[model samples]
Target: MRTGNTTMRAPGALALAAVGVLVLAGCGAGGNNMTLATGSTGGTYYPLGGEIAQLWSDNIDDVNVSTQATGASVENLRLLDNGENELILAINGVAANAANGESDFADEPLANPDDVTLLGNVYPEVLQIVATEDSGIESVADLKGKRVDMGPPGSGTEVAARQLLESQGWDPESDVEAFNSTFEEATTKLSDGQVDAAVAILAVPAASIEQVATGGTDITMVEIAGEEADQLMEDNPSYSTMEIPEGTYQGQDQPVQTLTNWASLYSTSDLDEEVAHDLVQEMYEGADDIGHDVGDQLDAETATESRGPTDLHPGAERYYEEAGVLD
Candidate 1:
């Protein structure tokens, strides 16, 4: 309910926003300009990505850092393929889709594109679905003949929602009406009873879900059930089990089951290995300067586990291997 809020960029803010841009490479080789393609400015990816961009700008004298607003997974990957962005923060499962050119999302059969390289993992994203209690939809299959918003077009949430629905034999176009709107708009529709459900895949304590819960309309989170969940875990190694506790989303006191998404840093092969190495090193070393809450995200322990199935970029591989994260 709180997303899509007006994120005011201060006057001349974009220019001065460079407190974290262009990490000055005082002792080394030439500096390289780097851009991080992050998700909707309204969501977690924006600030988190901004933190990284600033980290590079503030610490590494070898790179000029910038963060571009993007549509989370699908669009970020597209930007990478089109050479629009030098770096991207992708959902692990969605990254697999882009790597393989897998579904209707890409529809046009791609020739196994693989120009992107993985830097490492960032954090975990949960599949958080909010539905009105009045909708009478109790399960994933219950979504049939109902109205659902699958997040925005080209968003990681949209792709994940559709695929999970499809694997369950539900049709996005026919089984349920699908709307491609931001969580803010979708929540309004849901509150108005114009929509039956809305899906958002983000970290917990999500402002959007809190909006739905606190809005006076009763809500429920569905559990991704049975063998399909298992199949998804197997088919997509990046997905892992996550249980949402009751009361976490507006006092709906029952555990909701689902899979979680890992957010990973992906880059185009255009990046030089040494530059990539330095980028990884700087991210880890300068974590503290990015803001404590964000700094915690790049921590040495949990961060490494966030990179799903993608192979770490050779530069990152060297760092991770040396750090005892990889063999």
Candidate 2:
């Protein structure tokens, strides 16, 4: 992972070894200092977020950038609301939760949920439940009484895991012997016969899942569909249907039907409108710089579809309107 700033000040390396966290420092040459909050290292958010920060630092003058490791959507929203970070990469569903002051923010309601603004949509995040062959789990219902890794603490994965369990009429706290662990750690335990299944909602062909599948371990990617999936989407309007194409993973010859929550960039009202406009404009103009592999997910054509749950920032709206992305 790239760490430290690339401009504004001299770039220096600082690796936080606790959990694959890397902080990138850049010279705040243009006089604007801001931080970008991303997720765990193994997930898609960190890399993409790092690329975004780099683009902004390298292109936008006077904008100094710092990227921070966080617990993905939920944690990033908290940091953004608390004014710790100027920008955040978060899941649409989690962003909705934060905007409504529900779940994690029930007690500590954000002072200005209306101020949460969308920068652009990144891509769909599929909810994957991988069970070891030995666990005898065929469907989500089979998770009963089995030991499961419900993602890391304070993560969007954890929220989605619990929601899926609840939708199936199971008490996640009582029906399953639950443990909290990162996808990396959970993958190791799954291969070692320690955990029966792991609930992870991430970009397709996730590194963690690839780790287990390529290691020759017999694993099954359970599908979450039919009435249950419909109900899940209905309850959380931010969610949408998405499919994993055939051959996306080993032994997975058929497409898997699942629900997806979009990944989006967020900024609060505190950011200057003109600065926000420039940021959004540059993001589209510099799209090619983000690498083909990950950049494919950030299609500028559908960026306007990102306006859900949270309102679009005024500056971003101005740019999108002028560009004809928004009417």
Q: Pick the candidate with the highest lDDT.
A: 2
RMSD of candidate 1 to the truth, in angstroms, is 6.5
Superposed Cα deviation of residue 8, candidate 2 (Å)? 4.1
TM-score of each: 0.82, 0.89
Tens digits of per-residue lDDT for model 2, 1-327: 111233663132223223333222232334566677888877777777778778877887666566777888887887777766778888888888888888767887787788788877777778888899778887877898999999878788998998888877889899999988977789899999999999998888787898898898888888888887887877777777878788787777788888887778899877788778877777777778886256767666777574666888888889888887788
What's the lDDT of the predicted structure labeled candidate 2? 0.78
**Which pairs in model 1 have colliding backbones?**
1-208, 20-54, 21-57, 22-57, 23-57, 23-60, 23-61, 24-61, 25-61
How far residue 271's Cα lies from its native spot in candidate 2, in Å, is: 0.6
